[model samples]
Target chain A: MNSTSAPEPAQPTERIPAAERREQILAAASRVFGERGYSGATTDQVARVAGISQPYVVRMFGTKENLFLEVLARALDRLVTSFRQIIQEPREAGPAATELLASRLGAAYVDLIEDRGILLSLMQAFISGHNPVIGAKARAGFLEIYRMLRDEAGFPPDTIREFLADGMLFNTLLAIRLPDIFHEDPAAAELMRCTFRGKLDVVLDATAAESTDADAAPAPPAAGHVDAAKDDK
Target chain B: MNSTSAPEPAQPTERIPAAERREQILAAASRVFGERGYSGATTDQVARVAGISQPYVVRMFGTKENLFLEVLARALDRLVTSFRQIIQEPREAGPAATELLASRLGAAYVDLIEDRGILLSLMQAFISGHNPVIGAKARAGFLEIYRMLRDEAGFPPDTIREFLADGMLFNTLLAIRLPDIFHEDPAAAELMRCTFRGKLDVVLDATAAESTDADAAPAPPAAGHVDAAKDDK
Candidate 1:
């Protein structure tokens, strides 16, 4: 089953236009993988979707695995770009950093779930190990976002950080897939947002309170050692 | 593709005991469906796993579709029984209702994820539309759980009740699947628990606040003739 030979480089007569063909192939690969999953899908199906021959597809992508990995990578890039764009959008310019971050992140989540439900499907497919080659990359993309939100998003650092990470990702899935599950009952989404905001507020308030308490208490030289141990060991 | 029906359930064979045969068949069915998913899995494979003839498999379960539904339903019933047992467990004699609910729910969740990882695969198989026969039942089962939690969990009637419902279901899925993504990190599971608790606290607090607000507000008079305007047309 392994066809290991690398196809010869395209000559002038056989050369396809770069940008359009690449996008077309990627779109075909994405839809096919999304429908049939990686293991069940075939190159012929992808080629049929792209309106190209299987040989041409192999020439461009080398193997089905390579093509799937590229599609997953592109999906991740799309998520990162969408997130960054949402974050940079103007939200209550004068609010404190944490509140501003929360509102912005929440709004971004709503937009992504509502508009790009397919991305969530794609992410689920990748993470569920339906396709081994893309699964690793998809997981890396997820962990990358989790880390960025934990380290970069201006939330008060505490136990709540992990909670926010998991809850955010989890609720996003529900919001995208089962919109009807919440549609007939608007309270469903509202309750989720309220809980999310309220818990975040608690963490923020408590962290701020602790900061003042730290100022009043004598600085212990051993506190830094404990934190370093927590990080390192 | 339909095979001729076996002769009205052949008289019990003495080679195997009745209950043991049933257990062996069910266990094999689970493994077959779990591996190939509902649509792709075949009766022959199930028969192979059960170490019985294909005709015996058919006689035992009627059809492949019927067999798939049986396995799915059996899994769900087992899950319900497990959860009910946890909820009924004695909890320190007199813990607060809300805290007791949380601890029991959390323990059930941990047990569900750890002891039943195949459930995640089963859920994904159905949700991803890889198995339409099982998918319909799975979706129905989930919707039923959502209703029970939202309506019967004893939260006072309010918008936050819906939020609690959504979050509770969402947290359960994360508890099962997030560990797979963060497999090497010991903190992943702990983080999931903290996040669930914080969010649950938000729902509880919000419900309490809403009840207080309702108590302070004057009752609105019943609208006896609101239909008068529509009747005029």
Candidate 2:
């Protein structure tokens, strides 16, 4: 047992503030829902991943749909923050900078895959357009990012559109689990090699760790928040 | 009542060949599965859409996954045929021809949406990369298309990549039902206007007809094949 200290289960948040605990649950839910998909994932699975009781997950998010909505929102928030960081950074002036920024922006997006659920969860949200609530949020968020790339980032219209296009294809690759099939299929391997480039190892490692994680039992609820980022490695 | 057929209940396809009937069911299943993701679709629903009985659907496809696989294959085949048709057309030997050809290729891909399920079904299949068989098919088919654009269509590497990127984003916009919320959300409306350009009306009308189709009862099993393209209008 990894439990070093056992607090009474009733007051699980005695030390952590409500806001901080919410973040912890969201981080865990992101990975769970992103990996399993919204329909296939359950609140119980989210609780297990978050190292909290099922009732706690239900109490915090109210419903599975609500939990997913929050997770989706967080993923978008992270994306905006990532792009903002890149845009705010100082860079040289010229066509080269614009070109560099586009690739850098793309690399930043691909890097989000290391966070695992952030990009995958967004893909899940993107395709869930039939759902009234999720679909609206996905559209607004997607376009907001588009606007940021165009307006704030000063990317030309065609360049920014291509950037977004690349991002969309990247998401499709992940959704199809291209990394998993790459070794066996050369076509997938070539596509992965081209699309992922240097990040292929990181992508492969993240997904590989997940399959290994599939066998492990849920950590005890008192085990504390599992850092999805580090654990995924 | 739209039904004019007076066939015996047990002999719905008495006049139609089994092979022809298979195509009818696959066509219907493409729409049903494309509109509703694979897990959400049922054999009975597909049968009703195909204007055939449930037993016939089950007999032909054996299972819903099998039915979906056939639909997915048909979608890919259609994609290849459309692209090949574009690629084979006569063109001047110059950069302008390549430029014109790329747009022609994209327009052809977009026109596949007029078939409704063909494009949406491909979208469904693209994201279904989690399934073993479907994922394999999706990757192979997607890459095959990629190679076609690059090799046969004679697009430069970067250009072809963007073409695919645009196509993927196009699929995302459709999957999220961006056309539905274009009127209410300015972000959505703007994005739809830009991404769809001239085809905005076609995209909107297709989704609108789908929502309306949602309310209508399934066609009678003996009423012969329902041309989904015609009904969506």
Evaluate every candidate with DockQ and list the scores: 0.07, 0.47
Deviating ranges (above 4 Å) for candidate 1: A1-18, A40-59, A88-100, A113-118, A130-132, A156-233, B1-15, B18-67, B86-96, B114-118, B129-132, B156-233
lDDT of 2 by residue, B30-128 (tens): 887776667656677676677666777888888878888899889999999988987898877875887899888888888788786888788778877
Instruction: Identify the leading candidate in terms of DockQ.
Output: 2
Error of 1 at B93 (Å): 13
Task: Compare the candidates by lDDT and give the number of the best one.
Answer: 2
Model 2, which residues run further than 4 Å from truth? A1-24, A51-56, A212-216, A219-233, B1-21, B51-56, B154-156, B212-216, B220-233
Backbone clash count, each prediction separately: 1, 0
Q: What share of the true interface contacts does candidate 1 keep?
A: 0.04
CAPRI accuracy category, model 2 = acceptable
The residue-by-residue lDDT of candidate 1 on A124-195, one tens digit each, is: 443344234454565556556555566556444342353344444444324223333334545444443444
Scored by TM-score, the top model is 2
TM-score of every candidate relative to the true structure = 0.58, 0.80
Q: For model 2, how does the per-residue alpha-carbon lDDT over A99-212 read when each residue is reduced to its tens digit?
A: 888888878887787786898889878887776777778877888897897789987666766677788888888877777777787756766777777888888887776641
